[model samples]
Target: MTSAPLRWPDAADPVIRGDLTVAVAYVTPAGGAVVTSVSPLGLGERENGLVGFTTSLGFPKKLERILRNPDVALAYHTREHGFAASDSYVLAQGAASVDLRPSPERLAELMRASGPFLGEVKRGPLWDWLLREYHQERVFVDVELKRVAVWENLAARGAKAVTGAAWPHHPAEQEAPRNGTGPRVELAAVARQIHRLPHRLLAYRGADGLPVIVPVKVTSHDEAGLHLDLPAGLLPPGGRRAGFLAHGFQPQCVGLGMRTLTGWLTVTEKDAIYAPHTSKGLAAPPYRTLLTVSNGLLAKYGVWRAQRDGTSARLQALAARRPTD
Candidate 1:
């Protein structure tokens, strides 16, 4: 509908200022997409001239992929335990630049930026030593917004304006199934896992080379694929590549778990089907100290791997004039 700067939820909207997390999709080297839930803590304009998110070295695979292909998508589809209370679903896709291994001053600012949404940062030697991987070794990924789409509801119906990139108009009917399209995971097992975490999202690359994520509900499953009830309407016909993510998290970033998959999709007028190909995820202990220590170990390993492979982004956070404590 519209182009350039997105203002549907409003820059000052609580969703932008203090959402616990958003689903991000990045392209894999193989051309498939993967989705995960991450905190864009204090998401707003950054050094890269676009809204951004900070991530820790604890997740090296994710960081490396972003460095390789800057194209990424961010979807704000939650109004849970956060400062926001809106029904809008915002998806922004653009090139991403990583500021890895930021200076202490920059890291502190990023932490302070997230203070309001996550509560005061836990410091002191005891807390810092335990949570160093999370609070210390970090990077910022700023997205150069190309296109942003906002829908009135999670179902993604009734676009506010059809600005920048042209979205796929629903064709006359669902396309015929493509070869190599079938169920990846056992329906019974998938249902068991998703049932634990109610929030479900599916992401597929849009026609413009960006990822489009939408809310989905599982209707049933069989040998073909995991059947999903589309929220509003399926933008593109099925028989395409997609990613699925189901997750659950608590406030303060204490504990979390998620299931992610890369799959083939088949869409019809009433529903869509996902045939997963690859799957990977993590489940952190719910306790703060435990989670912190676990991340500490992973970060230690990640930093080493990043160093060994020479994939670290040791860029300084260029918030030169942003005064910080």
Candidate 2:
């Protein structure tokens, strides 16, 4: 086996023109290694454009297969900017193995550390924010190098090469049991409890303007204790509503409320809530609520009001318009 040095640029090369960085890992019967090549794939819509082709060639079918077989190898190659000299190209290859069932907690830590490298990618900008909002999860895979080979300035035809070999595995290869014991909170119950709050109101268009009305119980709590229902008729037009009766009100039925009201209302489509800092992290208590408003129904209500000559043209206009309006 051969060894090679991995070079990572501090900043994206201007001549390269894109932000894509290719990562390729190979797992074989003996071990596994990862090779990454960075080049500018371009900006915005052109990001996915060509820099170099990437493919995963030697992935093991399963953990059992990897353990039984164990031999693997992987390599990555890239050319210099402007097609300069063929010697300007680079290649790195090594023996590799597949690590199955990586630690979730450790993976999260690694992601936090790699924030800088990841931030350069498209999803990098939103990664931290999403993670903070309990929107992202992490999983980890570990690899040890058995050998490394590098070819630099392989640009046109001439290239320089370097190689090295190392041990693949160590005594630390013991598998740990999956983390299971943790506090589990019921999400549907929480949503139902939120829905049942007496002061909470659902927002909809009415005869006067935006009206906040209480929801009618469509069905009682099911075996899972979820009180699923829809909002009732709009409130009578006129006068500012008080208390939690305001449009877009989020009720705190559970102790784990964080930005409850504001987040829930704006969540006009789908919204979810999870227990803060649980052992299972974002996966547990995955409370989700999908708001389905009927623009057609609201329009029909306006049509009925117009046909009945209900007060004010503004009210009629609002009712007749689409729900999105």
Candidate 3:
């Protein structure tokens, strides 16, 4: 609901001061959104008023997407204790460029910015590997700050406030299914498929009111919700407002076929549970789950094209034979 300009290179910004890899989100060539992590080898505010970071030439999927569509978002997270934490994240709605062969001086600057996070690359196997395998191909991704949405204490403010950008926001409202509006026609079938897949990401409001994402292992997903096993410290004490996305991916000609459910999460006696909220592919209509499934299938075509033959089939088969599904 609010906008601001980014003030970079400040000693106070935890993103700059702390040594952590931020989750980066970007749109795929096929228009699907993908979230991944990147460790900045070098970072700082530039004279031109932009924040820059260095990453290896690895991850061709990300590199290709960045070159085609420069719009991107970055999230930084910190925890004071198991329960007290906040997300101080920034969204940069702008363009990014890749410099495949950065000059020696530039590479040094990037490495220095990364510091201890990049480890002591001065010598040892790490340095030797960098020189022999990766150094020559390293690239710098410089993001120009344009339209920005920054939440200093995201958990305290609530995730809803920062909902308008490329970052997938919470669904507005869940009304009863219209004649043909909600979920899929074979809700049971879809649910079976979803229950067979793995947990993708877990969500929780950080102490400051921002959404916190934790990758989790789901033991089960039944009428009650998702049963998960995660690190004890990852969750706050007691029930809290949270979300989860459990998804399976299949490759197609355009992008990917994704079966996913987004839901509210809470801690229970034996496991963390995710109660289905708004979903695509797996829920029954009047919710239009079919369209979500269709779109995801199309979007993943690009990603699947890069996979080996039968990979999609194997994943589909895996989803089909779950003991409870």
Candidate 4:
């Protein structure tokens, strides 16, 4: 008995004018041997117009179902004509699998193993062009036996071929915060105080969902100043505004050395001061006389002068009450 020649579909004669060749291979998972296909995947220009051809095949539903069950197929196609040819290989479902490139070493290993299969097509100017256009360092060939059948018809008829390209994956990076953890303010307390203030307090909720408060203080140097160290949790997102308000109020108060009929008051370094009875240069017939009077008034009125219409008015009132200027 004589062996039968491989049968292929009857198709139009493919126009091949270049040094390009095309080849294809098909594999089936159902214990079927790999079926090889070869073609001249190319196009040609004619007086009438440009002519080109492609040979492709479709598998039956039964074959597809069988492959889906766990069988795999491999397919490969290559064409060598003169100095140029097309090369391609595919791994059908279940035929082969690929994992993400691990380390540079792993990637290099894979490249080395695939180097021969990738062939000399990736050398010289062609390699440079591949690098420039596809941004790829190496190429790999995967064979799919089962799904390979689809292209059998194409290979048998000799169709024009083209190359495909892809790139590798990269990881992402993150950054750290700059300033060391400084003091933060208590947000809840600040919010409550802001709410109580007669004037609207500039308030905002931070990313953590806590309210930030504006600092308030007396500016006078000789006066007792209020410095509230807000709890850290309430600190504003950006400390600029809060820091400004806290420090900006420090210069308004008069210093302790200034002469006044009420006497030379002793101001603390922190800007707190005690009322005096006599001017710094003057000697009092009664040393404690003015102190006693001021203390008496403060006790009865609860420092009413601090809230007076004006600082000058408070000064005038104090001077008038003095025993003898």
Best-matching candidate per TM-score: 1
- Model 4: per-residue lDDT, tens digit, 129-237? 4333122221122222211112223222233222111111211111212332222333333333333322111122223211122212222222221223321222222
**Which numbered prediction scores highest in lDDT against the true structure?**
1
Q: Candidate 2 vs candidate 4: which has greater TM-score? A: 2
Query: In model 3, which runs have C-alpha deviations exceeding 4 angstroms?
Result: 1-12, 79-87, 122-130, 152-156, 159-325
Residue-by-residue lDDT tens digits, candidate 2, 18-106: 22232232232222111122222221111221122211111113322323333222222222122222222222222223322236664
TM-scores for every candidate against the unseen true structure: 0.84, 0.26, 0.47, 0.16
All predictions: root-mean-square deviation over Cα?
A: 5.7, 28.8, 15.4, 42.2
**Weakest 10 consecutive residues of candidate 1 by summed lDDT:** 314-323
Q: For model 1, how does the per-residue alpha-carbon lDDT over 173-255 read when each residue is reduced to its tens digit?
A: 22333546676566677778777876889987665567778888888777877888776564466477778999988876666
Query: Which structure is stronger by lDDT: 2 or 4?
Result: 2
| Candidate 3 TM-score, true structure as reference | 0.47
Candidate 4, position 195, lDDT: 32
Candidate 4 worst ten-residue window by lDDT:
247-256
- Model-by-model lDDT, in order? 0.72, 0.26, 0.46, 0.24
